[model samples]
Target: MCAEPGHYKPLDAPVGPEPVAMVPVVQLYARDVPGLAFPAGTDLLQILWCPLVHEDDQYAANPRLLWRSTELTAAGTAAGEPPRPHTVEEDYLPRPCTVSPTAAVEYPNGDLPEELADLLDERFDDLKEKQGYCYFEVATTQQSKVGGYPGWTQPPDWPHCAGCGTRMEHLLSVTATEPGMGRWLPLDDRDPRQGISAAPSWQAEADPAALDTFGHDMCLGDLGGMYFFVCRACPGTPYTHRYDC
Candidate 1:
């Protein structure tokens, strides 16, 4: 009687179509800073979900429902909170003066292209032969959309001091004499090319040709061992010097 005879089949006849699991969806984004939420890592995908009955606009308002991955969530994304692990990998961009697959790569400025790197390598050797060691300042002539370079500008009087938060005029300048030496250093951690050294190396002499080209006065004996490698327009003024360091 409780089974209702032939009409009442098994209580789990169709097996309830198996419980559907809530599959986790992940999304990624290229953020200015790290941990910005993105929808599916730039590669889009479609997802099905049950909308709340109270939702006024269903498809139009919440057409694409995105889920965030733990890696991209800021303090777990419950509300407006700064993201965790705020270190984003740098994207390398190409420069107009350099030969690259594209016009630019999204990374720190001064990242020289392969072709330009080769030029610097040659210049480095050339400078080393004449001077004790070679130095260079890899930079772009273009103005940044975000304003001011990582620090300085190519033009002298163009307010290098303001945006960079330092008086660029006071900063010392260095240029790569070696061809390709200024390009991205090898991934080899053991190599000195991995990063720039803070202190200037006294391994080479100054190139007279570079002096003539840059036009800065060649004080071969500025401090006995300290000679300046500057341009004609950048003298007497102090600059926030940046080089391989």
Candidate 2:
């Protein structure tokens, strides 16, 4: 008997080096990502990645971003049998989840020098105290989103594509959490009583003196984000990746 169309069949046994599967966690269209200037002709962005890390990078799984032309791909067929490597890190395996992109405003953490940060902190102390939220927290909050970098740092100076000298455009951000900051917690999910007052509890449970922060701990040892850029000029060319905290 033949299997039903679209039904996935597991292999009887494992094959070569465990193939890390690339699964789609989210899909964003040009409209979904505001402020980002996607190149013309590219309207769809697909974020996919292997949950497990490759042998070279033990810190985080590899993420792939594909800038697609929906009009050109609307009739494309789905693969019947995706590659499955034999061995994979069990810890890196991701539980299947879908994402709904939400537009958010973010500021670069590095944008403010220490002096400016201190000044702002002092200026906002009264409001922070009254609102029970810090200036930094307020400045960094982003709505629920997956795979987008915090504007904590200046936008990367993307290198020119090697194949074509076109300046690459930021395609997607692979992040562990939708919104890494606690302040960005959705209004429905936010607890009015849990800002500074909850710090003690959070600290107590945190990894001893380590760079433990929400969302950051899920990936590499540090709380940073990975960014991917594509050479829109060369549509079929490979993309480049960059990392930052």
Candidate 3:
């Protein structure tokens, strides 16, 4: 079977349970991705990943999120290129494209369990208009490339910190596609003939699967995403990571 222009057919060979090289996919400063309240003194947000498969339940590759203090790490010099992995799943790699993070309101997945939605109806509807879509739909903003607040599905329960048992705050999401890139293509990108294209040689050479993972990571055929949360109260505590389809 033929693959889509920017997508790759899954390989017949077996893939991973080990770590592959990691590369930086996107980096967002607190200013770039709005609405997020980062812990004081740590404002840089980076999303990096190993293109190869990992031992994840929903997806093979687990992307990593790091919060850093730019003042301490800044080297007053141009940044070097990110290193490439030795091997990767063609379907789990991402293309090299610039990110323009825009703020957007998001909604819960329309198919969430009725019982769960019923329980939060008052809270969800607080910002929702009587005649419009539910609060989860119209009032939430899906920021950056990460799929914010898990639309089309109920969000995973709030995670708790292992150390303090305090509920963590939603930091950000790392997603396969930028928010609203599909349903609302930009004016310059509106041509239907302008279909997906292959990744450039530099990206493809770094990892052949680069084109396949364009915009978002592929998780078991569904474009899956990862969520990161940090405990604001406990500054030194470990953060939490969650995977969702």
Candidate 4:
């Protein structure tokens, strides 16, 4: 219940509950992502889970992907601090932030291809009648990304590869909606007089009592999203996940 967060100092295991531990949900590397295949000798890419509520992927939160070798993997080198889960599902806790690898340029938030989703829904209804917005709400993005396309709310189930069934790829998106408003926020948390529009203004341009410091607030159920998938031709890279609310 107290998962260490008052800025350090709190390690000394041993409690009643037998098995639970699995936090830390993201740790990429491979020189901060640029193509990502990572298997031959691995360069890190962890993820962890067990915060609870896992009636299997549809109920969400069960992660566990590892890809290691940036040191710590041969039975976790000399591992330590990672065993807090006596009781969780505090909406699947997650508040240990610090992963900033931005590199935009995404499209397809609906998982298209019904002939480009009816010609991009008539070019997004003529780009919402001459740019009032909505090219999938400014080029698709729901938050917490890596490789793209999965911010789907429901419809695209997309998980295949149970060891060579193929069709896996996606690889990330632990989103309960990051971008604290408007066009995917982050122009240094926006509001430099706020005018880089495309029909912006869902608010949170910054400091409205610190919009909960934007993202990873993890209430991931009514507002779900867990996505991860891999199987790079399987052989230790196997993985799968998909949640949507």
Candidate number of the best lDDT: 4
Ranking by TM-score: 3, 2, 4, 1
Show where candidate 3 strays beyond 4 Å: 1-19, 56-59, 76-80, 107-148, 152-157, 177-220
| Cα error, candidate 4, residue 205 (Å) | 5.1
Using lDDT as the measure, name the better of candidate 2 and candidate 3: 3
Candidate 4: 10-residue stretch with minimal lDDT: 1-10
lDDT of each: 0.26, 0.49, 0.52, 0.69
Measured over all alpha carbons after superposition, the RMSD of each candidate to the real structure, in angstroms, is 24.8, 9.3, 10.3, 16.6
Q: Give each model a TM-score.
A: 0.17, 0.56, 0.61, 0.33
Q: Write down the worst ten-residue block by lDDT for model 2.
A: 1-10
Model 1, position 124, has a per-residue lDDT of 66
Q: What TM-score does structure 4 among the candidates reach?
A: 0.33
Q: lDDT ranking from best to worst?
A: 4, 3, 2, 1
| Model 1: per-residue Cα lDDT over 84-174, one tens digit each | 2111111111111211111222232343456876767877677768865434432331211111233222222322443334433211122
The residue-by-residue lDDT of candidate 4 on 1-245, one tens digit each, is 23322211113333334556668878888887877778898898888877765544365556678787876565656668655776566667787777555566787757766787676688788878996766766565777777878877777889899877869889788887775643465656655555546334433365555557756688677667888888777678788788888
Could you say which candidate leads in TM-score? 3
lDDT tens per residue, model 2, 156-238: 45557889787776556554433333334433233444553554221212222221322323432234455676775675756
Task: Report the CA-based lDDT of candidate 3 relative to the real structure.
Answer: 0.52
Tell me how far the alpha carbon of residue 131 in candidate 1 is from the true structure, in angstroms, after superposition: 7.5
Per-residue lDDT of model 3, residues 1-245, tens digit only: 11112221246354334335666766778776666666668878776766654554444555666778777658543578645665666556666666544344455555356898888878666645554445543434332335355432235666899878987766666554333323322222323343334321111121224334334443423545556777777756367666655
Question: How much does candidate 3 score in TM-score?
Answer: 0.61
lDDT of 4: 0.69
